[model samples]
Every structure is written in C-alpha cells, then in structure tokens.
Target: MTSSNIPIATPTFGQLLRSPVLLLAFGFGSGLAKKAPGTFGTVAAIPLWYGLQFLSPVAYLAVIAVTFALGCYLCGAASKKLGVHDHGGIVWDEFVGYWLTMFMAPAGWLWALYGFVLFRIFDIAKPQPIGWADRRVHGGLGIMLDDILAGIYAALVLQGTAYLIHML
Candidate 1:
C-alpha cells in the first residue's frame, strides 16, 4: 500500500473524532458494505450514548451542539483533503445524527431501533432541510447537515412514538 494511503500517527480517538475525513470514511465503510453499514454505524454509537447520557441533559446537549459545529468544519476539510465531496466512508455524520435521534427518547433498544430505522430513512430520503442541506451546503457542513436534520426528524418521530407507547 502507498505510504500516503496509510494514516501515519497513532490513531488518536479524539483526533479521529475531530477529523471530518475519518468520520466520512467510517460512514463510507458502512455504505460500501453489502449489508447495512448505516445501521452498523448507528449501532457503533451505542457505546457513546452509554457515556453521554451520564452527563446532565444540558451538558449532553452542549456536547452535541459542539460536535455538530465541529463536524461541519472537519467534514469539509477532510472531503477537500481527500479530493472528494461527501465521500461515502465518512460516517462521523451518521454518528452525530444517531446521537441527535436519541436526545429525548427513552433509552431502550426499541427506541434506538426506531430511531435508527427512522434516521436511515430520512437520511436516504433527504426531505426538506435534509434535501436543502444536501443540495446547497458545501464542505463539512454540507456533508453533515443533511444527516443531522434527518436525526432531528427521526428524534421527533421516535420521541412521539415513545410518548404514545408510554415509554417516555
């Protein structure tokens, strides 16, 4: 393999988190797999949720908000560095989107599944803000915005369902 192809540094989990390309590449890894990579990526987020939920809701929200903003910058940078727009492998956006989906929902496998399915649908469907972000926004913001919006929509659906089910 080419030296350029290899990531040289000891992979810093935090740096990877901050890297738009890494995130995008992760998502792409899911996208490239014959099976559902999106779902896999969403599943990958469960560990983070276990930790993030420990913080006060306000703290959690703040972290998510920061992550969203950082995602925009890093995603755009990585896309440019890789000389591609919205590469399939970048799944960091998926990570954040899934995080958004569970923001208010009762933490349960059922709710997560619902959020995951709903998030994947809206992400793929790209309706309204998702559509708008996909088309108009450029760079990392463009890459991540659509999924985040989808997350928001899915979160609503999941939360609503939870309310109806008396799970919230």
Candidate 2:
C-alpha cells in the first residue's frame, strides 16, 4: 500500500516511554515537539556529540558506524509500527547525521555550533542527491540516506571553512 493510504497517528509519549525503539527513534523525546521537531531533535543531539568528541577518531567512527546500523533498524521498525513512512517524530536519523557532521571538527563549542548550523542547512535545503534520496528511497535506510547526504555536505563545508580559518 502507498504510504499516503496508511492510517497512522502520531505516537504518544507513553508509547515512546514504553518502547525502547520508539524512544530512540523519537530522539529521546525531542521529536515530540509540536513545532520544528526536526530542529529540536538536532538540538538534542548536541550533548551526545559533545561526549563523543572525547573519543579517538577511530573509536568515534566505530561508534557512529554501530549507531548508524542500529538506527536503520530502529527507524524502520518505528516507522512500521507507526504505519508511517519516515514520520517526523522519527529522528534517529537526525542524531546520526549530526554526529557525522561533527566528525573531525575542531575542539570548541564554536566548531560544534558551526557544524550544527551547516548540518541543519544542508538537511533543510535537501539539495540534489539528498532530496533525491528522500523522494526515491523507502524503509529505514531511506529515512537515513537523505540525512547522511546532508551530513556529508555539511561536513565538507564545515571542514573547509575550518581549514581556511586555521590557515589565516
């Protein structure tokens, strides 16, 4: 059945609390916001990115890899349970995307803020392949792919900007 035909309701906080998958998928409750849920979800990822920054690069990448794998499953499962395709409340993808954007970032809150802004820009703009993936893909992987592209785009711009500033 087409996603449009699926009958689904926004999951309640109680349901999110009851289900581990839902909890993570909803970005630790940030996705529950009535307005700008995705933005809230991305904001919720900041603290997590802070802790992750302490890890060695290899370890950090490993963690991201594992989280991405788990997100694929969790996001897909949550979408299925909700009978929705990439529900706005499913923001595990945002967590992963933000983490990816922060990879190798400079050690400062300024860098983190820059990464956040860049990631949000690319995510919201959905330029080229990012938008293509969002329209063409399905399931959990689909939900994650668009954000992944956005993260990559943001990461490139962030790193380039950092490099230019450092060289100045």
Candidate 3:
C-alpha cells in the first residue's frame, strides 16, 4: 500500500529512544517536534554541516554519499517497523538533503543560512521532478529521492547566488 493509504502516527520519545535506528531516522529527536519537524531536522543538520566544512570537498561528497546510502536503509526500515511509509518523523532525508544543499557553499554563517532557506524552499515547494519522485518512487529510496532532488535544486540556486555575489 502507498503512504497515502497508511495511517500515520507519531512515535513517542520513549519509542525513539529505545531504537537506535529510529532515533537516527528521526534526526536524533529533532523530528519529535510537534510542528515543522522537517525544519527542525534541517536545523539539527547545521552543526554537522559546520564540521563537514573542514573536510576536503571530495571527502565531504563521500560522506554525503555514505549517509545517503545509510539513510535509504534507515528510513526504509523505520517505515516498515512503524507500518507507515515516509512518516513525517523520519527526517533522515532532511539531514542528507540539507547537507547536500550546503555542498560547496561559501564558508560563512550567512551562506549557511542562505543554503538553509534555499533548501527549505525547494523541499517545501517540491516542484517538477521532486514532486514526481515523491509520488512515483517507493520504499526508503522514495523517501530519500525527493529530498535529494530538492537539495540539488537548492544547491544550484545557492551556488548561483554565491557566484553572483562574487562577480559583483
């Protein structure tokens, strides 16, 4: 059955705390927020992004790649365990997407904020292929794919903006 047909129920903090996989899938409790859990999850990613900035670009990309693969498993498994596909509480996708959005972003809090805003806009808007993937894909990959697309879109916009600023 598709996510639309599955009834969604938020997992309690105790439930999350008991399952390591669920905790990570839930963005280390950031997804526990009653409202805008995705936004909170993205916010939770900022500290990680800050640390990732010290890595070489290639290393950073590798980290994202690894995390993306992990997220596919984590998100999928969490959905299966919860009996709900793409539960809003499964925000691992947001963590990866926000990181991808900040890829190669200019080094500064301002740029980080810009990346956050851009990523949120693209993720929330879900234009074109992003929305398509969300509708068409299934399982953990489905949960991650849409956000990956959104991240790509946001990254493009963020990089372009940085380019413009430098050019001026």
Best by lDDT: 3
Which regions of candidate 3 deviate over 4 angstroms?
1-8
Per-model TM-score versus the true fold: 0.78, 0.94, 0.94
Tell me the tens digit of each residue's lDDT in model 1 across 34-79: 4565667777776777678668879889979987887787667666
Q: What is the lDDT of every predicted structure here?
A: 0.73, 0.91, 0.92
lDDT of 2 by residue, 72-104 (tens): 999999988888889998999999999999999
lDDT of 1: 0.73
- For model 1, the superposed segments whose C-alpha errors exceed 4 Å read 1-36
lDDT of 3 by residue, 1-168 (tens): 224665448778888898898999999999999999999999999999999988999999999999999999999999987888899889999999999999989999998999999999998999999999999999999999999999999999999998999999
Residue-level error in angstroms, candidate 3, position 161: 0.5
Clashing pairs in 3: none
Kindly indicate the candidate among 1 and 2 with the higher lDDT: 2
